[model samples]
Target: MVDAVARLLRRGLPVTLAAVDPVLLELRGVLARAVDPGDEASRIAALDGTLRGLLARFPDARYAAAARALFGLPPATPGMNLTARRALAAERAGHEVHHFRKRVEPRLIATLTAELLADADRFTHAPLIAPRLAPVSARQPVLADPFAWEVAEQEEQLSLLWSAIYAARAELLAVERLISLRAERTDIVRAAVTAAWRWAGARAEAISYTTAFAPDLTIDELVALAGWTPPLTPGQTSRLTEAAAGGVAREQFVAHLHGETVLDDTWTTGLLAALQSTEPTSPEQPGAGGSSTAVPADPDQNG
Candidate 1:
C-alpha cells in the first residue's frame, strides 16, 4: 500500500495529491480498527514501514522545491526602479511560500507519522495496562496490576492515534488553501507592476515635453510648467539648471516662442491696436476743404 502511494505521488504530486489523500484516510480508518494491545508491536511496525516507503518516494527536497515554485517567485532581473519595487514585493511573497513549504508542512507530516508509529510501541510494551486501585506514595512500596495497566495504556494509544489522523487531514486541507493563495498573490503583484509601468510611461512623456519646451520659458515659468504641485526641492532645482544649460535647438526654440506669442490673445490684441492707431490718416483734397471758423477764449475758460 505504501509503495502504491509512493508511486502515485512520484508520478506527479500536483495531480496525485488529491488521489493519494483519500487512500491515506482509508488506511487511517483501517489502522484504527486493527489496533490491539497484544498485537501493537507488529501494527506499529507495519504502519512505520508504509509511511517510510511513502516518504522515500516523495523525497523532502523534491516536494519542497515543487511547493516553493507553486508559491510563485519574483522576476530575477529587475531592470528599472519600478521593476525593482515589483521584485521586492514578489520576494516578500516568496518568503511566505518558503515558510509553509520548507518549515511548516514537513514538520506537520513528520510529527503525525511519528505519533502513529510511537503509539504502537507505547501500547504494546507498557509496564502497566491499567491504573491501580490505590495511589502509591513515595513512602509505600509500589504495587500495580499488569493486566489493568495494559488496558489503560492501550486506551490512551487509541486516543492519540485518532488525534494524529485528524491533525494530518487538517494539514492536507491547509496545503490546498496555500496553493490557491499563491496564485492570488502572483496576480496581485503582476497587476501592481502593470500599473507602475503605465504611470512611468506617462511621466516619460511629461519629461520629454518639458525638455523640449523649457528654452521658450523663463526659469520661473519653466518651473511652473513642470506641473509639479509641490515646490521643487534644492536638488531638483539644481537639476533643472543643469538641464537648461544643455539648451534647445535654435529652430525648435524659435518655433515654440512663435507659438507662445500667437497664443497670447491679450498681447496680440494690444499690439494690433497700437499699429493701427499709428498709421497716417489720408490727406483731405483742397477742393473738398471748407473755410475754418475760430472762437475767442473767455477769461473764465483755461486755454
Candidate 2:
C-alpha cells in the first residue's frame, strides 16, 4: 500500500495531492478508515497531513532527510524526477543512492505501512476520542457534544491547557533559534539566550518528560526542586553542554526533539491553526490566538 502511494507521489503532485484520482483507488479502504468520511478536500488534507507527519517524525536525521526527499515532502524540495530525487536524497543524507535503495527505502516503506495501518486501527476505535477532538470549532464546539454542558466545562480547561502549551512551544522554538544563531559565541549574551532556552524547554518538554519519567511527580514538587537548585547564572554553560552532548549530538538531538514536540496532545484548535499557515514576522513569532509580541497591523489591511 505504502509502495503504491510512494510511486504515485513520485510521479508528482496536484495529481498526487488532488481531491480525486484513479491512483487512490487501490488504497481506498485504508484511506477511508484513516480519515473522517468527508468530502474530497478534507480527506486529501488528512492524507497529506499524515504523510508529512510521519515523514518528518523520524528519530534518525539521515533517515528523515532521505525519506522526505524521496517522497517529495517538506524540508525537501518538492519537485524532482526519480533520478533527481535520489540524488538530492544522497546529497542531503550523505548516503549513496545504492545504500538508500538497499536499506533506507525498505525501512521507510515498512514504517509508513505500519503507521497507515495504525491510523486505520485508530479510526476503528474512533469512539474513544476522534469526534470529540475533531477540528470543528469554526462551527460548533469540538469538545463535548451540544448536550454535555458539564463535560464542556472540563473540555474548556483542556482547550486552555492546549493553548498554553502551543504558546510555550512557539516561544521555545524562538529561543532555540536564538541559541543556535549564537552557538559559536560563548559569551554572557549566549548565557542569557541559554537561560531563556532552559526556561522555555522546561515548559515545552513538560508533557514529554513528565509522561516518560516522572508521572508520579507533582507541580509543587517541581517548584520545590527548582527553588533548591542553583541559579542558572551568567557564564553557566554546563547545563546546555550536558543537554547537547549527552544524547544524539546537538543538531540531530534538537531536530529530533523539535519534530516530536510539534504535536497537539490536547487535540485542540490552536495547533491546527498554527500548522495551517505561517507568515514572516520581524520581531517574533505569534503565540496562541494569533497574537504576537509588538506585532503591527498588516500594511495591506486598512485600520
Best by lDDT: 2
- What overall lDDT goes with each candidate model? 0.34, 0.45
Q: Estimate each model's TM-score.
A: 0.17, 0.42
lDDT of 2 by residue, 1-303 (tens): 656566644554333444234344324433553445455555665566666665666546656777677777654565677678777777677778888777767777677667666656654543222122456556665455555774665555444434434443454454334444434212322233333334333433443434454476453233222112223322332333334332233233333334221111111112222322443433333333443222222222233
Error of 1 at 86 (Å): 24
The segments of candidate 2 whose C-alpha lies over 4 angstroms from its true place after superposition are: 12-37, 74-76, 95-99, 115-158, 161-303
- The best candidate by TM-score is 2
Report the CA-based lDDT of candidate 2 relative to the real structure: 0.45
Q: How close is candidate 1 to the true structure, as a TM-score?
A: 0.17
What is the Å distance of residue 279 in model 2 from its true position?
Answer: 32
